[model samples]
Target: MLRRVRRQVADTLRVGAMTLYYLARGQRQRGAVLAQMFEVGNRSVVFTVLTLGFLGAIITLQAGFQALRIIGDTSLVGPQSLPLLVRQLGPTLTGLMVATRVGTGIAAEVGSMVVTEQVDALRMNNAPPVDYLIKPRFVACLVMIPALTVVGIASAFVAGMFTAQAAFHTQPAVYARFDVVKLSDLAEGLSKAVAFGAVIPIIAGASGLMARGGSAGVGEATTRAVVYSSLAVIVLDFVLGGLAFLVFA
Candidate 1:
């Protein structure tokens, strides 16, 4: 069991190193990068908007309720909810969403290529699969995940405004007016997004590259990719949050 664990860790590191090496050299298919970025960002917009909007509304309602009862100020919800969402919830949730959706998609696609021996064929043609496949994916995830997080965070505030008005009769601009989300909060969130973005594609693409045993293996690879990347996001969020607190607290 320990041997297997060690092997997995070694394999994961090898995959990351290869992908990073390719990323440093720049991409061969500029179109591929743009297509991937569109897939990662544009395709996820509705999901991000709806999920985050409702979540923001729920948070606003809860915070407003508590503030109303204790301090008789629904506007206080802005300070409690916006800062928390911007610094932690926004990036973490965004990462998890991308891991589940985009990570799984990348893994499944790559795993199909593996199961069908397309990757081997590409290599036979003297094409570097790592540069062609892994690098673009890594770049797309790193670039787009943070952008998606920003969109989601902004939408969440809009949703929170509606919820706050309904629950507490608070004005819509109360959140911004209070200056609750400092620059540090935004920085922390974006940093978390960057960490998560790196985690998702690297793990997913590596899992796909290692796929074997035909179609069943591809399915398993897809599942493992999403699971591993999601777990990585959660662990990273905890670590980054702790580091942020240590530095900023």
Candidate 2:
């Protein structure tokens, strides 16, 4: 089991390196990156917004209630939570959502091509499958995930503001404080976003490329993509958060 895990890790890293090499060399399929960006960014906007918005509202409402019960004041709820949202919740939640939705799609698509022998065909034509298949997706994710994170953060803040006002009678001016936020907070969030974006496609593409045994293989690849991508997001979040603390605190 340990050997298998090591092999998988090595494979993932190899794919990631190749993808990065292609990206640095400016190799891409025409229109492929644009299509993937649409799939990753435009298609995901509504889902990210709704999920983060409701989560923000619930968090603020609960915090407000607890604050009122303990101190007869809910004024600090927004000020306290805003920094947490920007530094932790926003990027983390968006990464998990992308892992679940986009990771599965990437794995399944690539796995299908593998099973159907399309990848072999590409190799026969002297086209490196990683260059043709993974690079575009990598570029797309690298560019779009940060954008989605911004949209998600905005949505969550707006929802929290409304919740604070309606549930605790806190004024918008009081709840919308940005003085608590710092450059380190933004840096940490964007770093996580970029890291997650880079990792997801490589892991998913590696899993897909390893697919065998036809349909059953594709199913397993899809499952691995989602599970591994989500785990990567969480682990990266923890690592980046700790680094931010050590460096900035």
Candidate 3:
């Protein structure tokens, strides 16, 4: 059992190293980088924006009610919620959403390729399939997810401000008076995005490559990719959040 555990650990490390190498290679391929950025980031814009907007509205509404109950000042809701949105919720939720959407898609596609023997064909042709398939995805997720997180955070905060104005009848001056620690908050959010982005696609893609059987195998790989990648992102969020607190607390 111990030997099996060690073998698994070693295998995981090797896979991680290979994924990193692929990402580096993909980064140098300008066309692949741009294409993947659009594929991963641009394609998912609607979902991201809608999620951010909903989050903003809900948090603003709830906080306004809570603040009115006690302090009778609804304006504090925006100020209170904006930082929480950007600093903690924004990046983490965005990452999870991407994992569910892009990560599952990647896993199923690659798993289908594997099960259909396309990966074997590439191997027979002396082509490194990882370079063509896995690498672009890893690089795209790392680059584009962070960029999407930035837009999400901004939208959530701004929409929160708007919500405060519309729902609470608060003036823009109330939001303008809010104190946001932009640098530390932005740094923490982006850091979470980058870490999650790198980890999720690799988990999905590698699992896909290991897929076998037929349609069932592809479905299993896709499900595992979504579940594991989401879990990993959540765990990494706590780790990164703790590290940020230590550094910027």
Candidate 4:
């Protein structure tokens, strides 16, 4: 178990180093990066919005319920939910969701390429896969995942407002007093976005690059990518969340 863990960590570091090396390349591959950005961001927006909207409703209902018991009114929901969502829920959920969607896609795509020897074709053509393939996905994931986190937070806020109004009689006017998106909170959330964004592609790409066998290998790599990326997001949240509290304190 320990040896396997160490091997995985070593693999992750090597892939992460390659990601960083290509991340600094100039605009020669801007088209690839932009294409990946759209795939990672625009294509995923609808799913994110819908998911966060419902999640916001559920959170608001629960917050309102608890606040009602303690404060005799659910008016506190507006101010309370934003801080929790923005500082914790927003980045974490966005990371995990996108890891499931985008990470698996990345893993399967690259794993298939590896298994089918398509990566070797690129090499035969004198094209480095790191530059032509991994860089775009790495850069795109870093940029777009944070943007998705912002969008998800906004959708949740809007949904929370409606739900709080309908289910708890906590007037829409309540959000007028919502002061939770403070600079400190924003710092925490954005920091998490950055960390989680970086985590997905590195781990997923590492798994894909290591694919063996054939179609069975690709499937296994994809599964490992999802599992590792999901776990990384949670573990990172725990570590980064602690540092955020200190940094933002």
- In candidate 4, stretches whose alpha carbon ends up further than 4 angstroms from where it belongs are 25-27
lDDT of 1 by residue, 162-198 (tens): 8777777787777555466788887789899999988
Candidate 2 lDDT, tens digit per residue, 135-168?
A: 8888899999999999999999999999899888
Cα lDDT for residue 219, candidate 4: 96
Models 1 onward score TM values of: 0.92, 0.95, 0.89, 0.94
Measured by TM-score, the strongest candidate is: 2
Q: Which portions of model 3 miss their true places by more than 4 Å? A: 1-12, 23-30, 176-179
- lDDT per residue for candidate 3 within 175-218, as digits (tens), equals 75446656888788878988988887788887788678999999
lDDT of 4 by residue, 1-249 (tens): 788667777998997887777667523664888999999998778988988888888899888888888887887788878988898898899888899889998999989999999999988986677667777888899999999999998898899999987887777887545565788888889989999888898898888888889999999999989988999999999998899787777
Q: If ranked by lDDT, best first, what sequence of candidates would result?
A: 2, 4, 1, 3
For each candidate, the alpha-carbon lDDT, in order, equals 0.84, 0.91, 0.80, 0.86
**Top lDDT: which candidate number?**
2
RMSD (CA, angstroms), candidate 3? 2.9
